[model samples]
Target: MNPSITGFDYQRVTVAEDVALNVAVGGSGSPIVLLHGFPQTHLMWRHVAADLAADHTVICPDLRGYGASDKPAGTVPDAYAKRTMAADIVALARELGHDRFALAGHDRGALVAIRAGLDHPGAVTHLASLDVLPTLDMWDVLHGVTAAVGFHLFLMAQPPGLPEELIGAAPDAFFGHFLDIWTRDPEAIPAEVRAAYLRACREAVPSIVADYRASAGVDVAHDRADRAAGNQLRMPVTVLQQDWGAALGFDAAGIWRAWAPDLEHRTVSCGHFMAEEAPAETVKALRDLLAR
Candidate 1:
Protein backbone atom coordinates (compact mmCIF):
# COMPACT_ATOMS: atom_id res chain seq x y z
CA MET A 1 0.00 0.00 0.00
CA ASN A 2 1.33 3.46 -0.91
CA PRO A 3 1.47 6.34 1.57
CA SER A 4 -1.35 8.91 1.34
CA ILE A 5 -2.72 11.97 3.10
CA THR A 6 -4.64 10.70 6.11
CA GLY A 7 -8.30 11.81 6.44
CA PHE A 8 -8.40 13.03 2.86
CA ASP A 9 -10.79 11.45 0.40
CA TYR A 10 -8.85 10.14 -2.58
CA GLN A 11 -10.16 9.91 -6.13
CA ARG A 12 -9.11 10.10 -9.77
CA VAL A 13 -10.40 13.25 -11.44
CA THR A 14 -10.30 13.19 -15.23
CA VAL A 15 -8.62 16.48 -16.21
CA ALA A 16 -7.94 15.92 -19.88
CA GLU A 17 -8.96 13.84 -22.87
CA ASP A 18 -6.63 11.04 -21.78
CA VAL A 19 -5.12 12.21 -18.47
CA ALA A 20 -6.74 11.77 -15.07
CA LEU A 21 -5.00 13.05 -11.94
CA ASN A 22 -4.95 11.14 -8.65
CA VAL A 23 -6.30 13.69 -6.17
CA ALA A 24 -6.74 13.87 -2.41
CA VAL A 25 -9.37 16.36 -1.29
CA GLY A 26 -10.49 17.28 2.24
CA GLY A 27 -12.36 19.85 4.34
CA SER A 28 -15.03 22.26 3.01
CA GLY A 29 -15.87 25.95 2.37
CA SER A 30 -13.79 27.40 -0.45
CA PRO A 31 -11.01 25.52 -2.28
CA ILE A 32 -7.25 25.82 -2.38
CA VAL A 33 -5.39 23.51 -4.75
CA LEU A 34 -1.94 22.32 -3.71
CA LEU A 35 0.45 21.00 -6.34
CA HIS A 36 3.52 18.92 -5.39
CA GLY A 37 7.05 19.26 -6.67
CA PHE A 38 9.37 16.94 -8.54
CA PRO A 39 10.73 13.68 -7.09
CA GLN A 40 7.66 13.52 -4.89
CA THR A 41 3.88 13.39 -4.94
CA HIS A 42 0.76 14.94 -3.42
CA LEU A 43 1.75 13.24 -0.16
CA MET A 44 4.37 15.94 0.30
CA TRP A 45 1.53 18.24 1.28
CA ARG A 46 0.23 15.88 3.98
CA HIS A 47 1.20 18.17 6.83
CA VAL A 48 0.09 21.48 5.31
CA ALA A 49 -3.05 20.08 3.74
CA ALA A 50 -4.31 18.74 7.05
CA ASP A 51 -3.69 22.09 8.73
CA LEU A 52 -5.34 24.12 5.96
CA ALA A 53 -8.25 21.68 5.82
CA ALA A 54 -9.52 23.09 9.12
CA ASP A 55 -11.02 26.06 7.24
CA HIS A 56 -10.37 25.63 3.52
CA THR A 57 -11.13 22.75 1.23
CA VAL A 58 -7.65 21.39 0.47
CA ILE A 59 -7.14 19.72 -2.90
CA CYS A 60 -3.79 18.02 -3.39
CA PRO A 61 -3.11 16.24 -6.64
CA ASP A 62 -0.16 14.31 -7.99
CA LEU A 63 0.42 16.31 -11.18
CA ARG A 64 0.11 14.44 -14.46
CA GLY A 65 3.06 12.11 -15.20
CA TYR A 66 3.69 11.80 -11.50
CA GLY A 67 2.80 9.43 -8.66
CA ALA A 68 -0.50 7.56 -9.07
CA SER A 69 -1.59 9.96 -11.83
CA ASP A 70 -1.85 8.83 -15.44
CA LYS A 71 1.38 9.27 -17.40
CA PRO A 72 0.45 9.44 -21.05
CA ALA A 73 3.50 9.05 -23.26
CA GLY A 74 4.95 12.40 -24.41
CA THR A 75 4.14 11.73 -28.05
CA VAL A 76 2.86 15.29 -28.54
CA PRO A 77 5.56 17.96 -28.58
CA ASP A 78 3.77 20.05 -25.91
CA ALA A 79 2.67 17.03 -23.91
CA TYR A 80 4.54 18.00 -20.75
CA ALA A 81 4.39 21.75 -21.13
CA LYS A 82 3.47 23.72 -18.01
CA ARG A 83 0.53 25.22 -19.89
CA THR A 84 -0.86 21.75 -20.49
CA MET A 85 -0.21 20.67 -16.91
CA ALA A 86 -1.79 23.88 -15.59
CA ALA A 87 -4.86 23.09 -17.68
CA ASP A 88 -4.99 19.66 -16.04
CA ILE A 89 -5.12 21.33 -12.62
CA VAL A 90 -7.84 23.76 -13.73
CA ALA A 91 -9.91 20.92 -15.13
CA LEU A 92 -9.36 18.83 -11.99
CA ALA A 93 -10.64 21.63 -9.75
CA ARG A 94 -13.72 22.14 -11.93
CA GLU A 95 -14.37 18.40 -11.87
CA LEU A 96 -14.23 18.57 -8.07
CA GLY A 97 -16.73 21.49 -8.13
CA HIS A 98 -14.47 24.51 -7.90
CA ASP A 99 -14.87 27.24 -10.50
CA ARG A 100 -12.35 29.48 -8.68
CA PHE A 101 -9.76 28.72 -6.01
CA ALA A 102 -6.53 29.84 -4.44
CA LEU A 103 -3.40 28.10 -5.76
CA ALA A 104 -0.11 27.18 -4.11
CA GLY A 105 2.83 25.14 -5.38
CA HIS A 106 6.41 24.26 -4.54
CA ASP A 107 9.42 23.86 -6.83
CA ARG A 108 8.34 22.44 -10.19
CA GLY A 109 4.75 22.71 -9.05
CA ALA A 110 5.36 26.43 -8.51
CA LEU A 111 6.26 26.72 -12.17
CA VAL A 112 2.95 25.16 -13.16
CA ALA A 113 1.02 27.43 -10.80
CA ILE A 114 2.65 30.48 -12.39
CA ARG A 115 1.52 29.30 -15.81
CA ALA A 116 -1.98 28.67 -14.50
CA GLY A 117 -2.24 32.15 -12.99
CA LEU A 118 -1.13 33.71 -16.28
CA ASP A 119 -3.24 31.53 -18.57
CA HIS A 120 -6.38 31.42 -16.43
CA PRO A 121 -6.34 34.55 -14.34
CA GLY A 122 -10.10 34.40 -14.06
CA ALA A 123 -9.97 31.05 -12.24
CA VAL A 124 -7.17 31.64 -9.72
CA THR A 125 -8.23 33.98 -6.93
CA HIS A 126 -4.86 34.08 -5.18
CA LEU A 127 -1.46 32.49 -5.77
CA ALA A 128 1.53 31.39 -3.72
CA SER A 129 4.86 29.93 -4.86
CA LEU A 130 7.51 28.22 -2.77
CA ASP A 131 11.19 28.05 -3.73
CA VAL A 132 11.26 28.63 -7.49
CA LEU A 133 11.50 31.49 -9.99
CA PRO A 134 9.53 31.66 -13.21
CA THR A 135 10.89 29.54 -16.08
CA LEU A 136 12.29 32.44 -18.12
CA ASP A 137 13.78 34.17 -15.08
CA MET A 138 15.14 30.79 -13.95
CA TRP A 139 17.01 30.31 -17.21
CA ASP A 140 18.19 33.92 -17.36
CA VAL A 141 19.65 33.90 -13.83
CA LEU A 142 21.31 30.46 -13.94
CA HIS A 143 24.66 31.00 -15.61
CA GLY A 144 28.31 29.92 -15.19
CA VAL A 145 29.13 28.30 -11.81
CA THR A 146 25.85 29.16 -10.06
CA ALA A 147 24.03 26.95 -12.56
CA ALA A 148 25.86 23.87 -11.26
CA VAL A 149 23.35 23.57 -8.42
CA GLY A 150 20.72 22.71 -11.04
CA PHE A 151 22.75 20.22 -13.07
CA HIS A 152 19.79 17.87 -13.26
CA LEU A 153 17.92 20.54 -15.21
CA PHE A 154 20.69 20.55 -17.84
CA LEU A 155 20.95 16.74 -17.79
CA MET A 156 17.23 16.22 -18.24
CA ALA A 157 17.07 19.03 -20.79
CA GLN A 158 19.10 16.96 -23.21
CA PRO A 159 17.44 15.74 -26.40
CA PRO A 160 15.29 12.79 -25.24
CA GLY A 161 17.42 9.62 -25.49
CA LEU A 162 20.52 9.83 -23.30
CA PRO A 163 18.91 11.64 -20.36
CA GLU A 164 16.08 9.12 -20.10
CA GLU A 165 18.35 6.07 -20.49
CA LEU A 166 20.98 7.33 -18.03
CA ILE A 167 18.49 8.37 -15.37
CA GLY A 168 16.41 5.21 -15.84
CA ALA A 169 19.53 3.08 -15.34
CA ALA A 170 19.83 4.05 -11.65
CA PRO A 171 16.61 5.77 -10.76
CA ASP A 172 17.00 5.58 -6.98
CA ALA A 173 20.37 7.29 -6.76
CA PHE A 174 19.26 9.90 -9.28
CA PHE A 175 15.96 10.59 -7.54
CA GLY A 176 17.21 10.05 -4.02
CA HIS A 177 20.06 12.50 -4.54
CA PHE A 178 17.67 15.50 -4.27
CA LEU A 179 15.73 13.85 -1.46
CA ASP A 180 18.97 13.66 0.52
CA ILE A 181 20.72 16.90 -0.39
CA TRP A 182 17.91 19.45 -0.77
CA THR A 183 16.39 18.59 2.58
CA ARG A 184 17.78 20.63 5.51
CA ASP A 185 16.54 18.32 8.27
CA PRO A 186 16.52 14.61 7.46
CA GLU A 187 13.75 13.94 9.96
CA ALA A 188 11.41 16.28 8.03
CA ILE A 189 11.05 13.46 5.52
CA PRO A 190 10.50 10.27 7.49
CA ALA A 191 11.96 6.97 6.27
CA GLU A 192 8.64 5.71 4.94
CA VAL A 193 7.80 8.97 3.18
CA ARG A 194 11.24 9.14 1.58
CA ALA A 195 10.92 5.56 0.41
CA ALA A 196 7.54 6.29 -1.16
CA TYR A 197 8.89 9.31 -3.00
CA LEU A 198 11.83 7.30 -4.34
CA ARG A 199 9.57 4.45 -5.41
CA ALA A 200 7.14 6.73 -7.27
CA CYS A 201 9.94 8.67 -8.95
CA ARG A 202 11.76 5.48 -9.91
CA GLU A 203 8.74 4.18 -11.77
CA ALA A 204 8.05 7.49 -13.54
CA VAL A 205 11.55 8.22 -14.83
CA PRO A 206 10.79 8.83 -18.53
CA SER A 207 7.78 11.03 -17.84
CA ILE A 208 9.66 12.90 -15.12
CA VAL A 209 12.52 13.60 -17.51
CA ALA A 210 10.07 14.81 -20.12
CA ASP A 211 8.66 17.21 -17.51
CA TYR A 212 12.03 18.86 -16.87
CA ARG A 213 12.85 18.78 -20.58
CA ALA A 214 9.70 20.78 -21.28
CA SER A 215 10.71 23.32 -18.62
CA ALA A 216 13.93 23.89 -20.52
CA GLY A 217 12.16 24.22 -23.87
CA VAL A 218 8.44 24.94 -24.20
CA ASP A 219 8.03 26.29 -20.67
CA VAL A 220 10.66 28.92 -21.27
CA ALA A 221 9.03 29.92 -24.54
CA HIS A 222 5.69 30.32 -22.77
CA ASP A 223 7.15 32.48 -20.04
CA ARG A 224 9.02 34.56 -22.62
CA ALA A 225 5.81 35.21 -24.50
CA ASP A 226 3.99 36.24 -21.33
CA ARG A 227 6.77 38.67 -20.45
CA ALA A 228 6.78 40.16 -23.95
CA ALA A 229 3.03 40.71 -23.80
CA GLY A 230 3.39 42.26 -20.30
CA ASN A 231 1.11 39.62 -18.86
CA GLN A 232 1.18 39.61 -15.08
CA LEU A 233 -0.65 37.70 -12.37
CA ARG A 234 -3.65 39.89 -11.48
CA MET A 235 -4.45 37.99 -8.30
CA PRO A 236 -2.71 38.66 -4.98
CA VAL A 237 0.49 36.61 -4.74
CA THR A 238 2.77 35.37 -1.97
CA VAL A 239 6.25 33.90 -2.45
CA LEU A 240 8.29 32.05 0.17
CA GLN A 241 11.86 31.11 -0.59
CA GLN A 242 15.18 30.18 1.06
CA ASP A 243 17.13 33.34 0.15
CA TRP A 244 18.78 31.62 -2.80
CA GLY A 245 18.94 34.98 -4.51
CA ALA A 246 21.58 36.19 -2.02
CA ALA A 247 23.88 33.30 -2.91
CA LEU A 248 22.95 33.21 -6.60
CA GLY A 249 23.38 37.01 -7.06
CA PHE A 250 19.86 38.12 -8.08
CA ASP A 251 17.04 40.05 -6.48
CA ALA A 252 14.44 37.35 -5.97
CA ALA A 253 11.62 39.62 -4.87
CA GLY A 254 12.46 42.17 -7.54
CA ILE A 255 12.16 39.55 -10.27
CA TRP A 256 8.87 38.31 -8.84
CA ARG A 257 7.50 41.87 -8.62
CA ALA A 258 7.81 42.18 -12.37
CA TRP A 259 5.44 39.28 -12.90
CA ALA A 260 3.13 39.82 -9.91
CA PRO A 261 2.07 43.35 -9.06
CA ASP A 262 0.29 42.46 -5.84
CA LEU A 263 3.06 40.35 -4.35
CA GLU A 264 4.38 39.51 -0.89
CA HIS A 265 7.79 37.84 -1.07
CA ARG A 266 9.50 36.58 2.05
CA THR A 267 12.71 34.65 2.63
CA VAL A 268 12.59 31.70 5.00
CA SER A 269 15.31 30.07 7.10
CA CYS A 270 14.30 26.55 6.22
CA GLY A 271 15.41 24.44 3.25
CA HIS A 272 13.79 23.73 -0.11
CA PHE A 273 11.22 21.36 1.40
CA MET A 274 9.92 23.98 3.81
CA ALA A 275 6.42 22.54 4.06
CA GLU A 276 7.85 19.40 5.66
CA GLU A 277 10.74 20.94 7.57
CA ALA A 278 8.74 23.97 8.73
CA PRO A 279 5.09 23.18 8.34
CA ALA A 280 4.00 25.59 11.05
CA GLU A 281 5.61 28.52 9.34
CA THR A 282 4.44 27.28 5.94
CA VAL A 283 0.90 26.95 7.28
CA LYS A 284 0.95 30.38 8.86
CA ALA A 285 2.23 31.91 5.65
CA LEU A 286 -0.53 30.17 3.74
CA ARG A 287 -3.21 31.21 6.22
CA ASP A 288 -2.03 34.80 5.97
CA LEU A 289 -2.16 34.58 2.19
CA LEU A 290 -5.66 33.24 2.42
CA ALA A 291 -6.73 36.05 4.73
CA ARG A 292 -5.61 38.62 2.18
Candidate 2:
Protein backbone atom coordinates (compact mmCIF):
# COMPACT_ATOMS: atom_id res chain seq x y z
CA MET A 1 0.00 0.00 0.00
CA ASN A 2 0.94 3.63 -0.41
CA PRO A 3 2.64 5.37 2.52
CA SER A 4 0.71 7.38 5.13
CA ILE A 5 2.51 10.71 4.87
CA THR A 6 2.99 11.75 1.32
CA GLY A 7 6.13 13.68 0.29
CA PHE A 8 7.75 13.29 3.70
CA ASP A 9 11.46 12.49 3.76
CA TYR A 10 12.57 9.44 5.69
CA GLN A 11 15.97 8.86 7.28
CA ARG A 12 17.49 6.28 9.59
CA VAL A 13 19.61 8.18 12.07
CA THR A 14 21.92 6.32 14.38
CA VAL A 15 21.40 7.01 18.07
CA ALA A 16 23.59 4.20 19.37
CA GLU A 17 25.42 1.20 17.94
CA ASP A 18 22.34 -0.96 18.17
CA VAL A 19 19.80 1.82 17.85
CA ALA A 20 18.73 3.95 14.89
CA LEU A 21 15.29 5.52 14.46
CA ASN A 22 13.32 5.87 11.24
CA VAL A 23 12.28 9.51 11.15
CA ALA A 24 9.92 11.37 8.85
CA VAL A 25 10.60 15.06 8.39
CA GLY A 26 8.43 17.72 6.76
CA GLY A 27 7.52 21.43 6.92
CA SER A 28 9.92 24.23 7.86
CA GLY A 29 9.45 26.25 11.04
CA SER A 30 9.84 25.80 14.83
CA PRO A 31 10.46 22.09 15.25
CA ILE A 32 7.80 19.87 16.83
CA VAL A 33 8.53 16.20 17.51
CA LEU A 34 5.61 13.76 17.59
CA LEU A 35 6.29 10.36 19.07
CA HIS A 36 3.97 7.43 18.39
CA GLY A 37 2.64 4.94 20.90
CA PHE A 38 2.91 1.18 21.10
CA PRO A 39 2.47 -1.24 18.17
CA GLN A 40 2.74 1.65 15.74
CA THR A 41 5.14 3.99 14.03
CA HIS A 42 5.64 7.57 12.82
CA LEU A 43 2.72 6.94 10.46
CA MET A 44 0.39 7.51 13.39
CA TRP A 45 1.08 11.22 12.96
CA ARG A 46 -0.17 11.26 9.37
CA HIS A 47 -3.09 13.70 9.76
CA VAL A 48 -1.56 15.85 12.48
CA ALA A 49 1.87 16.03 10.87
CA ALA A 50 0.48 17.20 7.56
CA ASP A 51 -1.54 19.92 9.24
CA LEU A 52 1.27 20.95 11.58
CA ALA A 53 3.62 21.16 8.60
CA ALA A 54 1.75 24.23 7.49
CA ASP A 55 3.12 26.11 10.51
CA HIS A 56 5.87 23.97 12.03
CA THR A 57 8.69 21.70 11.08
CA VAL A 58 7.24 18.33 12.04
CA ILE A 59 9.51 15.48 13.09
CA CYS A 60 7.82 12.12 13.52
CA PRO A 61 9.99 9.21 14.45
CA ASP A 62 9.44 5.52 15.19
CA LEU A 63 10.77 5.09 18.70
CA ARG A 64 13.65 2.75 19.57
CA GLY A 65 11.87 -0.61 19.56
CA TYR A 66 8.84 -0.11 17.33
CA GLY A 67 8.25 0.43 13.63
CA ALA A 68 11.41 0.77 11.57
CA SER A 69 13.69 1.53 14.54
CA ASP A 70 16.34 -0.85 15.79
CA LYS A 71 15.13 -3.74 17.92
CA PRO A 72 18.26 -4.42 19.89
CA ALA A 73 18.92 -7.61 21.83
CA GLY A 74 16.71 -8.09 24.87
CA THR A 75 19.26 -10.09 26.89
CA VAL A 76 20.26 -7.06 28.94
CA PRO A 77 17.51 -5.91 31.29
CA ASP A 78 16.43 -2.25 31.43
CA ALA A 79 17.85 -1.71 27.95
CA TYR A 80 14.51 -0.28 26.87
CA ALA A 81 14.00 2.05 29.84
CA LYS A 82 12.29 5.33 29.03
CA ARG A 83 15.43 7.20 30.26
CA THR A 84 17.44 5.46 27.57
CA MET A 85 14.67 5.95 25.01
CA ALA A 86 14.36 9.61 25.98
CA ALA A 87 18.08 10.06 25.39
CA ASP A 88 17.62 8.60 21.92
CA ILE A 89 14.93 11.21 21.25
CA VAL A 90 17.23 14.00 22.43
CA ALA A 91 19.97 12.73 20.14
CA LEU A 92 17.44 12.49 17.30
CA ALA A 93 16.40 16.12 17.65
CA ARG A 94 20.06 17.17 17.77
CA GLU A 95 20.74 15.23 14.59
CA LEU A 96 17.82 16.99 12.92
CA GLY A 97 19.40 20.40 13.73
CA HIS A 98 17.06 21.02 16.63
CA ASP A 99 18.59 21.26 20.10
CA ARG A 100 15.29 22.18 21.69
CA PHE A 101 11.75 21.53 20.45
CA ALA A 102 8.12 21.15 21.44
CA LEU A 103 7.39 17.51 22.23
CA ALA A 104 4.22 15.42 22.31
CA GLY A 105 3.79 11.69 22.73
CA HIS A 106 0.97 9.18 23.15
CA ASP A 107 0.76 5.99 25.19
CA ARG A 108 4.24 4.47 25.52
CA GLY A 109 5.70 7.50 23.81
CA ALA A 110 4.07 9.73 26.45
CA LEU A 111 6.04 8.00 29.14
CA VAL A 112 9.23 8.61 27.18
CA ALA A 113 8.32 12.27 26.74
CA ILE A 114 7.67 12.50 30.48
CA ARG A 115 11.13 11.15 31.20
CA ALA A 116 12.64 13.42 28.57
CA GLY A 117 11.04 16.45 30.15
CA LEU A 118 12.38 15.47 33.54
CA ASP A 119 15.85 14.41 32.36
CA HIS A 120 16.45 17.13 29.76
CA PRO A 121 14.18 19.94 30.76
CA GLY A 122 16.19 22.45 28.74
CA ALA A 123 15.64 20.57 25.49
CA VAL A 124 11.85 20.47 25.64
CA THR A 125 10.24 23.93 25.56
CA HIS A 126 6.71 22.55 25.85
CA LEU A 127 5.63 19.00 26.67
CA ALA A 128 2.37 17.16 26.04
CA SER A 129 1.46 13.68 27.15
CA LEU A 130 -1.71 11.94 25.90
CA ASP A 131 -3.51 9.19 27.84
CA VAL A 132 -1.17 8.21 30.65
CA LEU A 133 -0.31 8.98 34.24
CA PRO A 134 3.28 9.28 35.35
CA THR A 135 4.86 5.85 36.01
CA LEU A 136 4.55 5.96 39.80
CA ASP A 137 1.05 7.37 39.64
CA MET A 138 0.10 4.72 37.11
CA TRP A 139 1.08 1.94 39.52
CA ASP A 140 -0.53 3.71 42.46
CA VAL A 141 -3.86 4.36 40.72
CA LEU A 142 -4.08 0.83 39.38
CA HIS A 143 -5.59 -1.53 41.97
CA GLY A 144 -8.46 -4.05 42.31
CA VAL A 145 -10.63 -4.65 39.22
CA THR A 146 -9.67 -1.27 37.76
CA ALA A 147 -6.16 -2.62 37.40
CA ALA A 148 -7.55 -5.40 35.19
CA VAL A 149 -7.85 -2.84 32.43
CA GLY A 150 -4.06 -2.77 32.42
CA PHE A 151 -3.53 -6.49 32.22
CA HIS A 152 -0.98 -5.97 29.48
CA LEU A 153 1.12 -3.81 31.80
CA PHE A 154 1.30 -6.53 34.38
CA LEU A 155 1.89 -9.19 31.73
CA MET A 156 4.76 -7.31 30.17
CA ALA A 157 6.17 -6.36 33.56
CA GLN A 158 7.10 -9.93 34.29
CA PRO A 159 10.71 -11.17 33.99
CA PRO A 160 12.41 -11.23 30.59
CA GLY A 161 11.90 -14.86 29.53
CA LEU A 162 8.17 -15.45 29.97
CA PRO A 163 6.79 -12.16 28.66
CA GLU A 164 8.84 -12.31 25.49
CA GLU A 165 8.19 -16.00 24.92
CA LEU A 166 4.43 -15.79 25.46
CA ILE A 167 4.08 -12.67 23.32
CA GLY A 168 6.28 -14.12 20.61
CA ALA A 169 4.02 -17.13 20.23
CA ALA A 170 1.07 -15.01 19.13
CA PRO A 171 2.42 -11.54 18.64
CA ASP A 172 -0.35 -10.27 16.39
CA ALA A 173 -3.21 -11.21 18.69
CA PHE A 174 -1.31 -9.90 21.71
CA PHE A 175 -0.56 -6.48 20.23
CA GLY A 176 -3.68 -6.13 18.10
CA HIS A 177 -5.82 -6.40 21.21
CA PHE A 178 -4.77 -2.90 22.29
CA LEU A 179 -5.35 -1.35 18.87
CA ASP A 180 -8.80 -2.87 18.75
CA ILE A 181 -9.95 -2.04 22.27
CA TRP A 182 -8.34 1.33 22.99
CA THR A 183 -9.73 3.31 20.09
CA ARG A 184 -13.36 4.35 20.04
CA ASP A 185 -13.53 4.71 16.27
CA PRO A 186 -12.88 1.30 14.81
CA GLU A 187 -12.77 2.86 11.35
CA ALA A 188 -10.24 5.54 12.36
CA ILE A 189 -7.52 2.95 11.94
CA PRO A 190 -7.49 1.81 8.35
CA ALA A 191 -6.99 -1.82 7.44
CA GLU A 192 -3.58 -1.11 5.92
CA VAL A 193 -2.47 0.72 9.03
CA ARG A 194 -3.69 -2.09 11.22
CA ALA A 195 -1.78 -4.64 9.16
CA ALA A 196 1.34 -2.51 9.30
CA TYR A 197 1.14 -2.22 13.08
CA LEU A 198 0.75 -5.95 13.54
CA ARG A 199 3.60 -6.67 11.16
CA ALA A 200 6.01 -4.28 12.89
CA CYS A 201 5.05 -5.59 16.31
CA ARG A 202 5.32 -9.24 15.36
CA GLU A 203 8.79 -8.74 13.93
CA ALA A 204 9.99 -6.76 16.94
CA VAL A 205 8.52 -8.89 19.70
CA PRO A 206 11.71 -9.28 21.73
CA SER A 207 12.62 -5.61 21.75
CA ILE A 208 8.98 -4.70 22.43
CA VAL A 209 8.95 -6.95 25.47
CA ALA A 210 12.22 -5.46 26.64
CA ASP A 211 10.68 -2.00 26.25
CA TYR A 212 7.78 -2.86 28.55
CA ARG A 213 10.08 -4.71 30.93
CA ALA A 214 11.96 -1.47 31.53
CA SER A 215 8.72 0.27 32.49
CA ALA A 216 8.03 -2.16 35.35
CA GLY A 217 11.56 -1.97 36.68
CA VAL A 218 14.01 0.73 35.53
CA ASP A 219 11.44 3.29 34.37
CA VAL A 220 9.66 3.17 37.70
CA ALA A 221 12.95 3.48 39.56
CA HIS A 222 13.93 6.50 37.46
CA ASP A 223 10.57 8.11 38.19
CA ARG A 224 11.00 7.46 41.92
CA ALA A 225 14.43 9.09 41.95
CA ASP A 226 13.02 12.12 40.18
CA ARG A 227 10.20 12.32 42.71
CA ALA A 228 12.64 11.99 45.61
CA ALA A 229 14.65 14.85 44.17
CA GLY A 230 11.47 16.93 43.89
CA ASN A 231 12.26 17.80 40.28
CA GLN A 232 9.25 18.91 38.26
CA LEU A 233 9.02 19.69 34.56
CA ARG A 234 10.38 23.21 34.15
CA MET A 235 8.74 23.77 30.78
CA PRO A 236 5.09 24.43 30.04
CA VAL A 237 3.16 21.15 30.16
CA THR A 238 -0.26 20.11 28.88
CA VAL A 239 -1.95 16.74 29.27
CA LEU A 240 -4.92 15.35 27.30
CA GLN A 241 -6.46 12.11 28.42
CA GLN A 242 -9.69 10.07 28.23
CA ASP A 243 -10.62 10.85 31.87
CA TRP A 244 -9.44 7.57 33.31
CA GLY A 245 -9.55 9.37 36.65
CA ALA A 246 -13.33 9.64 36.54
CA ALA A 247 -13.68 5.99 35.69
CA LEU A 248 -11.05 4.85 38.18
CA GLY A 249 -12.18 7.25 40.92
CA PHE A 250 -9.01 9.40 41.19
CA ASP A 251 -8.25 12.98 40.26
CA ALA A 252 -6.19 12.75 37.09
CA ALA A 253 -5.32 16.42 37.25
CA GLY A 254 -4.32 16.11 40.86
CA ILE A 255 -1.88 13.34 40.05
CA TRP A 256 -0.46 15.25 37.07
CA ARG A 257 -0.22 18.43 39.15
CA ALA A 258 2.45 16.82 41.27
CA TRP A 259 4.67 16.32 38.22
CA ALA A 260 3.82 19.28 36.01
CA PRO A 261 3.93 22.55 37.90
CA ASP A 262 3.21 24.56 34.73
CA LEU A 263 0.23 22.47 33.75
CA GLU A 264 -2.91 22.51 31.59
CA HIS A 265 -4.52 19.16 32.10
CA ARG A 266 -7.86 18.52 30.42
CA THR A 267 -9.99 15.55 29.53
CA VAL A 268 -10.89 14.94 25.92
CA SER A 269 -13.84 12.83 24.75
CA CYS A 270 -11.86 10.70 22.35
CA GLY A 271 -10.25 7.35 22.07
CA HIS A 272 -6.69 6.45 22.98
CA PHE A 273 -5.74 7.14 19.35
CA MET A 274 -6.80 10.77 19.44
CA ALA A 275 -4.29 11.93 16.90
CA GLU A 276 -5.73 9.59 14.35
CA GLU A 277 -9.34 9.62 15.53
CA ALA A 278 -9.59 13.34 16.26
CA PRO A 279 -6.72 15.08 14.53
CA ALA A 280 -8.26 18.53 14.55
CA GLU A 281 -8.88 18.44 18.29
CA THR A 282 -5.44 16.95 18.85
CA VAL A 283 -3.80 19.66 16.76
CA LYS A 284 -5.81 22.39 18.48
CA ALA A 285 -4.73 21.11 21.88
CA LEU A 286 -1.13 20.95 20.71
CA ARG A 287 -1.33 24.45 19.20
CA ASP A 288 -2.56 25.71 22.54
CA LEU A 289 0.38 24.04 24.22
CA LEU A 290 2.80 25.56 21.71
CA ALA A 291 1.28 28.97 22.34
CA ARG A 292 1.82 28.43 26.06
Q: How does each model score on TM-score?
A: 0.99, 0.98
User: Which candidate gets the maximum TM-score versus the true structure?
Assistant: 1
Question: Which lDDT tens digits does candidate 2 get at residues 174-238?
Answer: 98999989989999999989998898898888888888888888888999999999999989999
Candidate 1 residues 1-292, lDDT tens each? 7888999999998999888999999999889999999788999999999999998999999999999999989766689999999999999999998999999999989999999999999999999999999999998999999999999999999997999899989999999999888998999999999999999998898899999999989998899899899999999999999978999999999999999999999899988999999999999998999889
Using alpha carbons, what is the TM-score of model 1? 0.99
Candidate 2, residue 58: Cα displacement in angstroms equals 0.6
lDDT against the true structure, per candidate, is: 0.93, 0.90
Candidate 1 clash pair list: none
| Off by more than 4 A, model 1 | none
N/CA/C clash count, model 2: 0
